[model samples]
Target: MSSSSRASPVKWGIVVIIVSLAAYYAVYVLPRGELGQAEQWRVLQAVEYDHRASSVTAEPKLLQNAAGSDLSALGLPTGQKTSPFTWILLNSDSGDDYGPIKMLPQGQSFTISCREIDDVSAKVVIEPAVSAYLKSHCVR
Candidate 1:
């Protein structure tokens, strides 16, 4: 074969290899990468409230990007009286969009500590103060 003909085959081979790699990355790696990014955005940071005085505590209330029923749980004065136990969404930096803690309940006797957890779906534990409150309040 002539030198020019031989070079043509080599160039074609390189092109084929490049195309194959591009296809492999698009088919296998691209989707997973996008999913990972989406998951990172979906990661939610929230506070689980525990009243130190009454010992009353509830689950970690997930902070939403916008205000809604979640605000009511935190006793942010959404004009909803659905539940006596009030929660508060203090601060969230898990994402760019975060809701503010609007209204703190008036005359709340118990002191609350809010902490962030890795997994929002994880089960919330009742703190020692909450346990004591439940014990005393649980009437037999």
Candidate 2:
């Protein structure tokens, strides 16, 4: 076995390792510039509201009132007469896209917390009712 041939595989392996590390950092470790703090907060709040609203059969007025107060305290205005429940479903892999769960009333906003569970899935923590609603209507 020639020294040059032996060295070739090592060099390729090192290059592959470097590229893999770079991709990992780019995809997971690096902060997403696309989602600013305010946007993230909104997404989170929306999910929480949805989860909380879903748990109870009655109207989610208390949950909505609390959420509105929280938002107001945070200096974000809650629009008038909006639904008490909001849904936000975060894509585990992508930082760019999310939508409300189907069962949630449209235009309600809640909070969401997302952590990557693996390469393919994310652990999303939302409000209790929102989570229940999602489990019933959206969980796969």
Candidate 3:
């Protein structure tokens, strides 16, 4: 093959790789990373839970994005709310049987002993407002 033919393949390969990466970032990374998109996902996934809800639990950290800024800290309605119930609703994967959150002592780590079936779970101490919200909304 001529030198230009060899270089043509290499250039095309670079173009394909660049396009693939850009498409991945636009379709996957952008939606998951942006605040508005993340919030939308959170909302769509949300299910109500109350004290009576099964297998629910809360933790001090945002389980979805442990290292990222939490909603509560960001000053959103759900932010800073003790929302183990909401967390449970949000965090459960498809096919995971989730239950109500077990209450925790203030500032203590939360746990999910309430789960009647196998699941990956954790806990966090929730604020009163979060608990109240769950209690009120989860029942309906």
Candidate 4:
């Protein structure tokens, strides 16, 4: 075969490989990425009261005491640096988009540790304080 004719086969092979990769990404990787991202968001974020305050504010905050609804604290072992509890301040359930969040350990109370940012909520991890709080409260 002539030199040009030989090159045509190589070019066609490259095109085929690229097309196959693209197809695989669309078929397998796309849906999984979407689902995994949403689930990851749920696990990392805990939908908070402030974001959805409109409903509560209109009713002047339902002043009800949880006399019997609190979870009976599970018996956690001693000397545990981290508790079974995880603190994640989730966005509102109106399906607000949370871009990406990363947990960074900071020495502060759990409430103040999380610094909310525009589309990024990565400021989630708190240090020894978080472990202490987790040992006490089971509130998600």
Candidate 5:
């Protein structure tokens, strides 16, 4: 084989590897990173997914490790009249059942629990606004 033929495969291999890495980063990392309020929602989703699928505890710290980004400082809504969703409460449960956030008040909120039967279940009690948005976006 000529020198160019040997170099061609190596170059193609390098290109393929680069493309694969780029695709992975684009599809996985970017979407989960901090993008304002969406960051808060995605973090909650990932935590709930983890809780339902494999854990009884839903803690926010674990998200930073999984997403390759520091989401530890991500704050939840405090119902201060910023947005429609501006008053949401974030509840988490490590027991067999979710915390009683529904009875809190008129403000919106969600819970992350682990009383799920399968991985296909979602333990995150998404607010109506978030759920509706997901439905409209076809993100079921």
Candidate 6:
């Protein structure tokens, strides 16, 4: 066969290899499930809490009240700050079993106890406004 004819087979082989690899990733690797979904959520919460605590110490005026204090005394209308980081807590579980806690600064670190509410759902509370930022930037 001529060199040009041999090149066609090589190109076709490369195409097949690329297609097979794409199929393997899409069918096997991608669907195996998020390996660190739970861990990732925990880390996100911890980071947000830590950031909030630090922010409170750095800028005392930002944190108005403790988380679980009187909501009325808490800052209202949720003003946006100049900080690049923010945190938010998302209730993935159903029902309103837990008490509503006061809003903390984006820098406070807190220990969150996990409680069962329902099957296939749970709450992942991130401090400040990280959830919004993540949703906007991370999600496609």
What tens-digit string does per-residue lDDT give for candidate 5 at 1-140? 78855768778899999999999988776654433335444554554344332322222222233234333211222223332121122222111122222121234342322321111124334444433332342312
Model 2 spans with C-alpha error above 4 angstroms: 8-17, 20-24, 27-29, 35-45, 48-79, 83-140
- Which lDDT tens digits does candidate 6 get at residues 1-140? 78765668778899999999999888766543353133333444554454533332221122222243211111111233433234333322211112122232444332211221111022224332433333343312
TM-score for each prediction? 0.26, 0.25, 0.28, 0.26, 0.29, 0.24
lDDT of 2: 0.38
lDDT of 3 by residue, 1-140 (tens): 78855768778899999999999988776654444254433443332222213333232223433223242211112222344332332331222111222222223332322231112222334444444434443211
Better by lDDT, candidate 2 or 1: 2
Alpha-carbon runs more than 4 Å astray in model 3:
1-7, 35-140
Residues 7-115, candidate 2, lDDT per residue (tens digit)? 6877899999999999987776564434433444554566555454233322222222224433211111123234434433322222332332322344544332221
Query: Best TM-score goes to which candidate?
Result: 5
Question: In model 4, what are the clashing residue pairs, if there are any?
Answer: 46-88, 46-89, 46-90, 47-90, 102-122
Which numbered prediction scores highest in lDDT against the true structure? Answer: 2
Report the Cα lDDT for residue 37, model 5.
35
| Residues 6-83, model 4: lDDT tens digits | 768779999999999999998777545655355434333332222222221111111111112211111111222342
Q: Write the per-residue lDDT of candidate 1 for residues 6-32, one digit (tens) a residue.
A: 668778999999999999988777544
- For every candidate structure, what is the RMSD over all alpha carbons to the true structure, in angstroms? 13.0, 13.9, 13.5, 14.8, 15.7, 14.9
| Candidate 2 similarity to native, TM-score | 0.25
RMSD of 6: 14.9
Once superposed on the true structure, which residue ranges of model 6 sit more than 4 Å away at CA? Answer: 1-6, 26-47, 50-140
- lDDT score, candidate 5, position 115: 24
On lDDT, the stronger of 2 and 5 is 2
RMSD of 3: 13.5
Error of 6 at 62 (Å): 23
